[model samples]
Target: MAQPTTSILCTDLGFDWPDGTTVLDGFHLAVGPGRTGLIGLNGAGKSTLLRLLAGELTPASGTVRVGGELGYLPQDLTLDTTQRVDEALGIRAAREALHAIESGDTDERHYAAVGDDWDVEERARATLDRLGLARLDLDRTTGELSGGEAVLLHLAALLLRRPDVLLLDEPTNNLDRHARSLLYEAVASWHGVMVIVSHDRELLQHVDQIADLRAGSVTWYGGNFADYERTVAAQQETAERLVRVAEADVQRQKRDLIEARTKLERSASYGKKRSESRNDPKIISGKLKRQAQETAGRVRGMHTERLTEAKERLTAAEEAVRDDAEIRIDLPRTAVPAGRTVLNLDHVRLPYGTRAHLELRGPERVALVGRNGSGKSTLLRAVAGEIGPLEGEISTPVPLRHLPQRLDLLDDGLTVVGNVKSYAPAADDNAIRARLARFQFRGGRADQLAGTLSGGERFRATLAALLLADPPPQLLMLDEPTNNLDLASVRQLTQALAAYRGALIVASHDLPFLRGLGITRWLELDGELRTIDPM
Candidate 1:
């Protein structure tokens, strides 16, 4: 094996829970050169392992040895209250440090703080520029940027540290497709060992390895995301077959044990006298009969216990093996008026102080693509009736619901169930609970403060609200619905859309999904909607 430029060796890594629960098992992870995509469902010990590798959390049982420097940017980052994008990236601070260093009044202490080199300020600026944050407002404070923007700025800061190992947990969670592209390119060109946990299948394809964590152990898969899927599918099929075989064996063992005991069942033909003799026990004949009965009972009990234990063992073994992902969703019926133009905006020009005009129509399932702030959301809002155009009018002659890019539809303070209730009040709790279950948000999860839910859960909850509404929106308008979703969720959502009959106006950057869905038409940010000619 060629020595990795950077690597971390984790042996039997484990972590305990607050309630003496073991969240991380004897998980062994070998992180090395190139990109590695770490993935797991919500409570699956993925984040815990990432924290261990980053040194933020220590293992309860194992040693973590890092071969080189490591930089980490968590999915959720807390910035200094008054920090600006530029300051967070160390650009402005670096400049200030330099000014103080050059104006030195023989103060060696200050010089050492900024790295013995006076040119460090220049390097900071160069790094910030490479991160596309060169034009950031240094004094204005990060409170001005959106969640997605804040994530990017902090990522730039970590990159500034230039660690040999780079770890980003769900880095693309809140970013738009364009922003995600920025990450994709950066990770591809990065030379250090990079470990990432993202829900984007396309993003996972960029990695060199896939690690599946389950049942307290780690299974390593070579190759990228696509390769892993095929292998996993085959493995799941075999596992299911094995489960059936094990079950059959357990049943067969139970029958054999029962039959063996039945054979040992003594005949009662010795009559009541023999039976009474066994009961009396003082007579020799009675003693012999009692001994035989006692031996037979013991033998049967032993056989039963062993078979029962075998059955239990088989059950545990079956569960320990990996299974198929749960992807079934039941979206309630919503009627899209047949043979009618759902949305129409002819010679529709956007109002003053915004992006240009365009002629478009509803009942059109098309993607909206453009660079960030090139007016994708602005146009979407116009279609959603949140904004009015100065130059022309947009007529929505059909029932429609829009899932925005920023997910601004939500008010942060409500609980998951409460927010969902706001959309469909008349839905009895059971019906609502069922809908939430389909989206993987039910029970205490639905009771959790929506604000506390992770990016993915929040997005999913929002989707549940939209699709499970009273009448369900026939025409669905979504703004980058894939932003916070992991690759599995994205795939599931895509599968759901595949079966949808209503008109869809979506804005997404997942090219594979776009092509897979055979999206027939699209509108660009410049008020241009083009149809892909059918072959």
Candidate 2:
């Protein structure tokens, strides 16, 4: 198979933060004309690379060359809520120019602004329609649109621009199932040079290839996410085997070195005894002793060199093995009895007009899923007692804790252990540290300030605090827990949740994650709480 044309190229790329922290140094990449899924751990420079390619950040060295026009959608899109839809789409000037021309204003400025693209409005509308925004009016303010709609609108703007190179940073983040499907369709249909930095498995499944970024470099893998996973798993298995073989070699070398040293020592002792017994001439004995010492030194040096080489090989092999830690904890105290009532909502009317009347019993794992702006977060907040319902009662017979989407419950000024201590005041320091270790924050990690943690680390720290809270929450609620998490972190969260025996209610758009949780019930909130099948 012939290689696709390289549309995005970076060579000897170097970048550093103002604090002198190096993000990328001598990094090189060549992305061809197809969808490339860029994946890496949090803070591995995936977003930074995209920004460089999009010309949002100036590189300290090297060049970024694109074959044609480029467009970028950053992870955090801050759109002015007061801006009109047309303004956000970037065609408002052209639209106004055309209107002026129609009104008999033949100013050269108007003609220049209108350019040759007379049907910009038509193209914008068609683009919006393609992205499932057919009903979105150009005259409406951005505030009128939901979060998902806003994302799609930004994408529509990029699509209308028809850039040859497109870069998307976590495009599906915070998107609902329907919006994600639309985004997936858009990605699947893209025929340009597209590089997307996302951890959304479903979105990644639509890519043409995978670019595994680590240590400021890219390793390309043919095919989509599943193919990448299979290849990486096989490679890891081989790496682990190599590490085992290296370890065995090191042990053998150590044993050989010790044996060689012992034999030399025995030989020297035997020589000394023989010399004393034989009563040889003084000069002859002295010469023989010196020769024996030289031989012994050579033997010991050879064995020592071999052992050093073996140990070096072992270290190299071990370096190839990934150390992605996982969360492991047992929370028997959080378990709920089969006949216990966890929560009850009596005709609860949320602030956003969504009404829910439900009773949660036993250790039910419930999935709360719906479109954006459907009041999923609001409902979760109401249940958590963070907000009072419009005119209803929510009762939790047992202790409950909520992990909101923003994860702001943690105090940035405090350490991970300190945060957990705040939640579990009665727990001793050693006990809290031990429990935190299970969450992968052992020793120094637990003492690091919350403000200094990466996204995944912060998530784990917050989760530990919640689960280890005093009184032990029997019912735990999480709002979009998987958002902004790397794939490994997602797996870690799944493992942690697996050990959770409490009643769980999670509001998330991640179907794969929800399915893995063994959700016993699925609920959709859209002005009314309705039982739905697990999508």
Candidate 3:
């Protein structure tokens, strides 16, 4: 492996949205060769930072210095549909020149075009194969490829460049299991500086380190996600202990101050009474009274200062404890009886020509796993009645709702509450807003236009709209629900699903996420759908 020629450095980096929302301020980071996973909450500027480093976006004020070549893959990657695979790989000219030379053209221009990468085609093919795109034809147009395949192709192109610094934003979002495995292998074998922003737990496990972006800053962890979690948990336990100790200290200090004040007040009262009773010498009485008042002030100040210091310590201790809130929700109305049959597919031929025979009972949680283009979304749409099956029939006994990958159920012009209201006309605005609040949209946020929401926020709004529907969907089908969600959002989704009592059939490649949901059945789809062991 080639050593890094230059490290990625950022000094006094600052960035803001067009609307003047500051995302990064005077930020600094120095990254050398090693795979680093960038994890953060939604709207943490992970993607923006990557774009700035890639030159896709300019920092407001700062320096971004890269020692060597850089390649970047954005979250939403789009290629010209008319462009051929060879062109997309960036080797069209070279490949054509090589072909001309092989045909005995003997043109000097051809040689110049080929340069030293005479085996570029072979290398490209090898790279594609490594990314599980071995069957993709170099001459084929990109229009024919699926979303996941396009991502793999783009990665192959970047790998061919042998860049010193590579950045990927949510690379595995829409990828299938096979593609994810290939990506994991690539990351494991990477020798250069790699920064990836993703919520995929499996992908994060392969990184050498984790960079947590929060509150417009980055905190580095020495190992992968699991290690990071362990370290954070340990730190949180210590913080909680400190907070408890600090609270106890504050209480003690408060009591001490009160007791001291009471004693001083009582002593002052006694001194005044004694002075009044004595009336021996005016000068002596005055001196004694002044001394008592001064002493009381001194004592009061000392106790007050100690209490203030204790309270400050308590505040600092509380600040040290992380306040990452968990999603608390209830979906009792979505429940189905244990013996209720929620769905039945009898020899149903999917749009992709594959036949599926399956039955979902009670509140069974099913995971639909397959390759990228194996019709998971298609089948999901069929079940949702968005599209009809080619043959046979699909029987859904309860109210069903489908959360598609694109989240098109929401109208961009409508507010989050308005979208929900559209779905459940009988539901009042207050009721809808209350349910939206459970999905993390509170107060004014519930009235924010769907078009203005971030990717994660949009997904949550869509989910809220679905679950908050009148009659409450008892058969929920989600297609790639975790695609653009941050780790926190993903966990929120998991928590929400945990409370849901409806039957679920989610098509996703996130194995950890599926297992977290306690899936009752594992179904794999290739040309046909079949049950598989939960490995």
Candidate 4:
């Protein structure tokens, strides 16, 4: 098939980590104009590929070509906390020059700086408003902005540049529902070439196409994420059917081989008897015996070859099927009684003027959601006893564990097994290893240092440590647990939560994840907790 026109292209791209671990070898991609969602497992080199395209990382071999000016938003966008918002937006110089020109200074340098972009401030404000950041003050420092707001500000800066190609890595990682909607709108209206590496389903739904990266290769699927899923499902079905057919073919071949051997044996036995009874010459008898043996050998060889080919076909067919592993564990000890009062908060006042009066009982799953800076994290910390409520009485009748968004609970210097061991010090090494294995940390992986683990691995490690603590938690609180997790990791988390028979409270803006948790109550934290319908 003829290749489509491309604004970004990577030809035979090869890259390796400092430790010589190969990431992408001979990888090739051609992304045309329009938005493309690049998705894969956590460590499938999606981010690495973006860095290569953005010139942040050099390939070990091969070349990357981009059509025009490019703008990139990394997953970990770091802005100097002391820097002013206008400076971070890359409009401070222009704004200053315009002010000077208006103040009666006709300096050539001022005019040169404000060249053609005389309306930079107005455009900047409009862009910020479009991204749901109109409340952000340009004169204020970025340190005052929330994580989601910082991301939006960076995106706004990129928008101002109006590059021919744009790359976003997990752009909605910390965004709330409203902010994500704004981002989706921006993506929908983008006319230039764009590639976004993200696990956000809603963001993926806005893409023009889906580029699935697996095993260092890219497979193009037309339409959005839903369409890609449907196509993949159909392909898997066909692959499974082929595998069954190949398996049957192998079985038939084996049966034919057995029958051929049996028939040859019978013919040889009959011939031997006939030769003996006819009193044929010894030489003639020997020749006939040899011929019979040769015939049997050829038949056996042919049948063996047929069976081997069938098995090979089966292997190929099976290879086409995906086997994404899911986490499965039973935590019976975490179960809460039907009438048990897990937590109670009476006129609780949280940070930022948020208040709540709520009672959580039994194994109720609650989803706490709201806009950016709405204090969902503050509420979770209060429940977990990590932070005290400003003015309220909080009670927890049962033990609880909290998984914060940063996942900073684990010691980077310690191994995954060591971190778990620290949490469950009373448990023996064998017991700890056994539990960690269930979290998909088997053998050497369990010994891997927490600092070196990938985003998905880190999340799993943190979860295992929390769940396997000395006292099994009856109430589990998670704050934006899916922030940096890939889709597979999110599914794995859902599976793990499914096995936990405990009261759960998750603070997140991910409506799909919250819905999948079977939330019994939906509470929005907009200065006060109020019951809301399921999202």
Measured by TM-score, the strongest candidate is 2
In model 3, pairs of residues that clash are none
Clashes of each: 5, 0, 0, 0
Compared with the true structure, what per-residue lDDT tens digits does model 3 show for residues 200-229? 999999999999998888899998999999
State TM-scores per candidate.
0.74, 0.95, 0.93, 0.92
Better of 1 and 2 by lDDT: 2
Off by over 4 Å in 1: 1-5, 9-30, 45-65, 77-161, 173-179, 213-218, 253-310, 321-325, 347-364, 405-422, 433-459, 513-518, 526-535
TM-score, model 2 to reference: 0.95
* Candidate lDDT values, in order: 0.72, 0.92, 0.90, 0.92
Output the better candidate (1/4) by lDDT.
4
Whichever of 3 and 4 has more lDDT, that candidate is 4
Model 1 local distance difference test score: 0.72
TM-score of 3: 0.93
> For model 3, where is the 10-residue window of minimal lDDT?
320-329
* lDDT string, candidate 4, 153-198, tens digits: 9999999999999999999998989999999999999998999998
Candidate 2 lDDT, tens digit per residue, 1-535? Answer: 9855649889999999998989999989888889999998888999989999988999999999988889999999888999999999999999999999999999999999989989998998889988889998888889878777888999999998889999999999989998899999999999989999998999999999999898888889999999999998998899999999999999999999899988988998999889989998899899989999999999988999999999999899888888778787899999999989999999988887899999999999999998898999999888888899988899999999999999898999999999999999999999999999899888799899999898888999999999999989999999999899989899999999999999999999988899999999999988999998767
Error of 2 at 339 (Å): 2.0
lDDT of 1 by residue, 1-535 (tens): 9865578788877799776878876667777788888876555777777888888887889788888888888876777757765578765655566677677744665655566556765665665566665666556687766666777788777776778888888887656666877777777778878888877777888998887766666688899989999988887777777778778878887887878676765443354366575565457655666777787787778878878877886787688565424446755476455576777775566643444444334345677665555566777788888888776677777667888867666667988788888998898777777777777775888788777776667777777788777767777888877765666667767766765667787877666666666576766664444444431
RMSD of each: 5.7, 2.4, 2.6, 3.0
lDDT for residue 453 in candidate 3, whole number 0-100: 94
